[model samples]
Target: MSLRTALVAHVVSSSFYLARARILLSPAGDNWLRGRQRHFEQGGVPMRRAFAASVALLSLALFTLVIVASSAQARSERTQATTITLSGWSAGKDEDDLLQSVVNTFNSTHSTIHVDYSVINGDYSTAMTARFAAHNPPDVFYVDSSVAPSWIKQGVLQPLNTYIKKSKYDTTKFYPGLLSAFKVGKTIYGFPKDWSPLATEINSAMFAKAGISTPPRTWAQLTADAKKLASSGAVPGGKPICLPPDWARMLAFVFQNKGSLASVQSPAVTAAVNYYVGLLKQGLAATPTQLGVGWPGEALGKEKAAIIFEGNWLLPYMKSTFPTVHYGVAPMVKGKVNGNLGFTVSYSLAKDSKNKQAAWTLLSWLTGKKGMTLWMSKGLALPSRSDVKAIGGRKPFLAAGPFAHGWGFPNFSTTITVMNNDLQAVINGSMTTAQMLADVSKSLKG
Candidate 1:
């Protein structure tokens, strides 16, 4: 029987037993029983039968109280909700606020689960790794595609196949490219929360001042426009573009040229590198550090550069922080192929989490169609699911989704770190493009 039914039966039984005992011990009942005992002595009733009935009634009363108390304790446990912790890194105030709002909604809506959301402001992977090592990891946390392989190898993430099956979550709604990043063999470790593909951002005022009417459509056009903007002094210090010297940023060009970073000697790779080096040589492009800025977004916001290649996250940043800067976004410049790089982070449940079911509930809600739509409605990130429509001026970002490639390289974090450290030499002319590629390839192999 159901616990509720069992509890109701126990309560009724206890009340019945207590009533019987009270009647037996009452003054009127005692007088009547004594009269019966007197009659029994006269051979009308049995005295031994009366005494045995009193003993049995008293024992049942005490046993019924114990059972009632045990039933009450069990019912309390069954009604209580489970609470789980969620952890993630925040890029800025806007991103944090949006995440907290969604989390609030989930906590309020779920009757059986409570989520405590925490933001780790510093290095995300390092902080999360420490938590895992100490056996105090959050029940659910964000995992970047770049570092997923290593985490999977270490078996720190729980395989989500069973939860997905039991919940009947429609995994097919998500972009396959992003979803595959969290998979090892046939097991999925997480569900992608959101994704952002690199797109070209151009300052409209700068473009108009340089006599350019529209954003560039090809690599050659981009280079020509940069040169024109630089010569016309439309950008600060006559630098037309700010490109971060990182492989993550440069990979778009490699992929556009139909090249793989794994094969540095291929003609396509050589062509892609040569194109970037040529722009640097012409003084039309500068890295963010060279312009005394921390990132491409800042350089564009401050008018240090007329154009930049950045992610969709820049839209919210620009709206809130750089409100006066009029700009337009377009898909990344094309080459032999249409290519743009997509970066994504997923919600993963910890393998050792004590509240696994509760954690899964939060994960499912956060990455589900309704929750994801709410989170991406602000346009801080693009929705990973196909069914979620872009709201709040996210058309440009959504337009780039078709041809965007995810960060799927094996050991992606280490490879990007090595490239970021070594590629600066090539940009500054200390090393040739070929040499830089060779060095990066060798380091990755090692």
Candidate 2:
């Protein structure tokens, strides 16, 4: 073959090969090389890849900023001056003011913490249960003495034993009887914030009109005077002065009768109930419901009743609402048992609370003399602290009158239940005192 023909054929073949290669690989190859060059310029990232990387970096920075802001907000919450909500039952103006003063004082003293107080209002038990179920419970709440035991059993309250131990307070600083009320098993669920002596507040003028000089101390004397009061009709409201057939008081009477409502489940409680029923039948005392829709306090306050068995807390209320009334306080009429029935309230810490330390601090301050002073000033509660009494004794209340140093029956929640449930049923003629004893014994068994 001629050299020219061969060269032409070779060139055509080479051209054909180059054309085929370009058709098959040019677009992808060009893109890959351009990407590689861009990557080298951008620290080995392809153009598309660099764009994706830039978007990722921006997204990460935004996410980091969001996280930082959230953390900052959380930190602010931990140190904010806004209040930690405190939930409690509704008290009248005087009581509210006293509690507020304590809270305000604490807030002013401690710049880091503020307590926002709120009243749970009526049906406190039901409201608390609902709130607990919602997992939005109040940071602090007032627990009643009678109900604290049941709540502890149900695990609704956190044991305060650890906090109590860590506290600078000495448990012995309180009255042994009052301190014992808040103890459950081996743990203390609460601390005593206030206490009261149960006393019979009487209309001295009525007693004088009835020709009685002193308050009755024995059941027999009480019965006699009560009868005379009923017959004399010298009570201010023009109604016969009489004791209300209260189950709680009846239980106290049973206790004074040298009878155990449930402490010993014998036939004595039944006898006690029978005796109370007889008292009611004899018209010595009227049922609370029959007193013209008046509570014992109202009855006494309005002068419809000349006497009432109540706590010392009532004196302030009586003085504030019924200023001109002449009244006297005396120890509860003695029972044959020769002892007083009492109930005590205690403040406790919450186990699951986030501000446990702060809670403990508040509790410590409130239970101490400072809190006691606030409470005493309002006359809403009696101090559990003996020191507070020593600091400002008989002069606090007794200076205003002769009949101070009043006393109440000694009983805790367990005894209160017996008094209210078993003893009450017996007194109301719903059950024999024996039945009440048995029922209470059953409750105690568990």
Every candidate's lDDT: 0.83, 0.63
- What value does the lDDT take at residue 363 in candidate 1? 94
The lDDT, on a scale of 0 to 1, for candidate 2 is 0.63
Q: What TM-score does model 2 achieve against the real structure?
A: 0.68
lDDT of 1 by residue, 1-446 (tens): 65456445645765665675577679987887787666656753465565555556546555767777678766775578788999898777878888899989997788778788889879988898898899889999999888888899888999999999998988998887788789977799999999988888999999999999999989989988998997787885638988778878888899899997568668898888788767777788888888899999998898889989998779877987899999999878899888877798899999999999999998998899989988976767789998998776677777767777777566666677777777888877688777877777776574
Clashes of each: 0, 12
> Over the stretch 62-116, how does candidate 2's per-residue lDDT look in tens digits?
4444565577677886677545666777667767777888888998887777888
Residue ranges of candidate 2 with Cα displaced over 4 Å: 1-83, 230-241, 258-264, 301-304, 320-324, 390-431, 439-446
Best by TM-score: 1
